[model samples]
Structures are given as C-alpha cells and as structure tokens.
Target: MSMVGNPVQVGRRPLDVDLIDRARAGDDHAFASLLGPIVASGYRLAGAMLHDRYAAEDVVQEASLKAWRSLRQLRAGAEMRPWFLGIVANECRSVRRTRWWSVLKFPDVESPAMPPDDPHTTFAELRRGIRRLRHRRRLMLVLHWYLDLPMAEIAVITRSSEDAVKSEVSRAMRQLRGLIGVEDA
Candidate 1:
C-alpha cells in the first residue's frame, strides 16, 4: 500500500495515541495516517542524502517496510519522527554503501562554463562541497539545514548528545565553507 499523500502539520500537534493503538493493532490506514506527514520529511531527507530521486524513493520504501515490521517494538510514548527518520537515514547509508560509485558526481569539464555568480554555479559548488564532506558530517549538514531539524532532534536521531550534534553542525558548516571557499567582500 502506497502511503503517499499530502503532508500535514508536524512538530506541533502531539502524536495521536488512538492512531498509534490502531496501527499497532494491524490497521493499515492507521499506520498510513501516522506516516502521512513524516514520510514527506523522510522522502526529502533521502533525496538530499542520495542525490537521486529514484534511489531516494527506494530507500524510503525500504525504510517504510522496516518501520512497519518493527512497529510492535515501538515503546509506549516514544516519538515516531526520530524513529522513522533514523530508519530512513540508515536505509540511505545502506544504499550508498552498496552502490557507491553510481552516486559520485564528477565535474563536466566538457560543457561550457557558466558565469561565476550564476545561481546554478553557486548551487553546483554547494553540492560539490557537500559531496566532499565525510558521510556523517554530510548527514548532519543536510539534516540541520536542508531538513530544518533542530539540533536536539538530530541528536536523538544520531544517538548523540545535543552538544555533539551542535558541534558537528558547526564543524560541518566550517568545513563546507572551507571547501566552497569564502568570497572576499
């Protein structure tokens, strides 16, 4: 069953206890309801990490299966966002490990170069900088910036302390800036 649907508000409303109970009782729609908004973030997170739409889709699909299989193991009062996102992140890592070479992006030396200040050029440079980062740092950067997740939440997902998550995000930013180089104003 495809759980795709319009994203609803998240991070605001509390988890629906009724929905969780229904899902745990083997109700597919209840599970889908629980996943509705969270899956959107999972899809985006996978897409940014994998840099391939189809691969990201596959990762999310696999993660959803993993999540469904383990729903019974979810402890009462546990937050679903971090749990599901962690699963998606793990799946992305697995995919990257299995097919590492296919995701690498080399410079298109043969193509005509764009102007230095062009938005496309800047974005391409940013992407290259992100790719050069270590996997963990890259995930931190994407999660904090691209996904707009708080350091506290990222800490939970990464199984690290909040201070560690903050330090990593700061270091990732510095490293990315160094890789991208600074513009003298």
Candidate 2:
C-alpha cells in the first residue's frame, strides 16, 4: 500500500515491510511513517485504559519512544498495530502502578460530548458500565470490542493465552450486561 504520489515501494513488499526495513536502517521518517496509521488506535487504547486524555497522551508518547528504541526486537512479518498496542498497554500499567496519586489530583477535563440524540444516554451508561469492570476485564473488553482485535492478538497484547483472552472477553461481556441491567437471553 504505497502512499499516493510518493509511490514508495521496496520490490513489491508491503508498505509496512518497506517502512520497517527503512526504519531499522536508521531512517526516522520511515519509523514515523510506520506508526502513522496506528497512532489513533494507540491513543484510543491509552485513553480507554487511563481514562484521562492528558495521561493517555503521555503514555502514548512514552510508548512510541520505547517502540522506536526497541524496533529491532519486533519480529519480521508481525502486525505492527498489536505490537505497538502491547507497548502502550505496558506503559499504561506502569503509569497506573507508579502514579496512583495522579488519579486523585488530576481532574478530567473532557466531558462526554454526547450529540443531541437519544443513543447518547445508552452510550454514557455503557461507558459507566465498562468503567466499573475489573481492570483486566475492562482492558480485554476495550481491546476486543473497541480495538476490534482478534482473541489471539488480544492474548499477545495482554500477554495471555488465546483461551484466556476468550474467557475474559466472555466474562467481561456478561459482567457488562449485568452492570447495565440487561438480562441474559
């Protein structure tokens, strides 16, 4: 998938492969290019996990730096999205562990900007229900549903087996249903 006009191609390789090759050869532009598509997803993941946009931005920035420094460790032919998300997850966990006090001190600046529609109510309730879930379950739900990743990739990002990821997603959904007061059919 070459960018339009630029037409960067490395002998029929995929765009990511070409970018990875260039990045690994000390090309900073290629590294940024590789991260371009997935950066929004990474930010969304961080915001979901951290529940604070400022902190989430910081976590993503830190994760990007780590990804850049450790680009050599990324396996060939691997999907960069999940790999980068895993780093974001790890960074979120680290921030949570070390900066617990920040949660109390930091005020959430962004309110839920619901549109003038009835579905906004349901969306707010769902967000609240998701927030009430246990951290691991919430992370799994965000990764599976929000990020739309497969169970195997979720397992890799969360550092668990595929079976465990499946079970967590199931349990999380059930818990969310319960929290939202929706009876199981």
Candidate 3:
C-alpha cells in the first residue's frame, strides 16, 4: 500500500472490532490489514519528524514491529491511530538520538502536497524554519498541523493534557514565525 495518501480520519473511520480481536489474538493478516491505514499516517508523521524518507521508513517499520509486539498492551476498543502514532513518534525520537543520525546529511523533508502559500515566505522556507524548532515543538506541529490530528489524539501521542497540547502548538507556531523572521503583525 502506498504510504503517501488517504489518511484515515479519526472519528469518521469506524473501528472494526472483529479485526482488532483477531489481530490481538495473533492473526498476522488481520494485523497487517488493520495497520495499513495507520501506517500511512505514521509514515507521514515519521517523515516530518526524521526529515529523511529512508529514516522515516525505517522508523515506521520499527514502530510497526513494536506495535505488533505490544498489541496486547493496547486497551480494548482504544483508538489505534494515536497509540500506533505514539510508537512511531517515539521511534523517530529514538532514531534522532543515535550517533548515525547526525553523521548522514539527509535531504530536506518535503510535504506530499503544496502547503498554502504564506505571504511572507515559501513553504520550503517555512519548513526550514520548522526544522529550527525543538524536537517536542516539531513533533507537536507535525502531529497537530501536518497530520490534521485532533488535540486529544495529539495529547495521547505527546502524553500531555489536551490543554497542554493546545498551548504547545500555539507556542510552536509563534516560535516558527520568529525563526522565519516574520514579525508579529
């Protein structure tokens, strides 16, 4: 499945209880099928986090494996997207901490689609400014703005309260604007 398109909308998409049960019971096919949509979203999340397609792929792959191994840890009927994304986010963070992450000069991460034009700068320039953000701030922006995930879902991934997530996103945007040299107007 292509990891670039058709992200599942959280509330709009219904969870398949049967699929979850079978996957939780150790059915590989069921797990793969269930994880397909989530993985695509996870890939986007990882891509934004790691800034390298190969590293994003590796991070998502590792996250998928971790998700599979920890499937039992998922609460019954819990939303899988946030939970799996949390794993993916953690994997990206872990990869960034390793020595190899800095030795390589990975290409800049480009978003799948053109973002809305900013009067002050191009999207690519904006992305460069985003790169200057701290890891947690970057993760917040990626999860909240890039993924179009709701605050509650982002909260789950960040392990913060919804209010805290909201506050961080707002602060991150301000920091991004500052980094991009956009004066408050």
Sort the predicted structures by lDDT, highest score first: 3, 1, 2
- For model 1 the TM-score comes to 0.85
Give stretches of model 2 more than 4 Å off: 1-13, 16-18, 101-118
The whole-model C-alpha lDDT of candidate 2 against the native structure comes to 0.81
Model 3 residue runs over 4 Å out of place are 1-12, 106-121
lDDT by residue (tens digit), candidate 2, 1-185: 55432333221234546677689898999998878878898999999987889989999999999999999887765667778898998898788778563456643244566664568666777888887787789899999898888888888788899999999899999999999887887
Report the poorest 10 consecutive residues by lDDT, candidate 3.
Answer: 1-10
TM-score-best of 1 and 3: 1
Question: What would the TM-scores of all predictions be?
Answer: 0.85, 0.78, 0.83
Clashing residue pair totals per candidate (backbone < 3 A): 0, 0, 0
Per-residue lDDT tens digits for candidate 1, residues 3-101, read 223222234445656666678888999899888879999999999997889989999999999988898866656667887888999998888788464
Error (Å) of candidate 3 at residue 85 is 0.5
Query: Comparing 1 and 2 by lDDT, which wins?
Result: 1
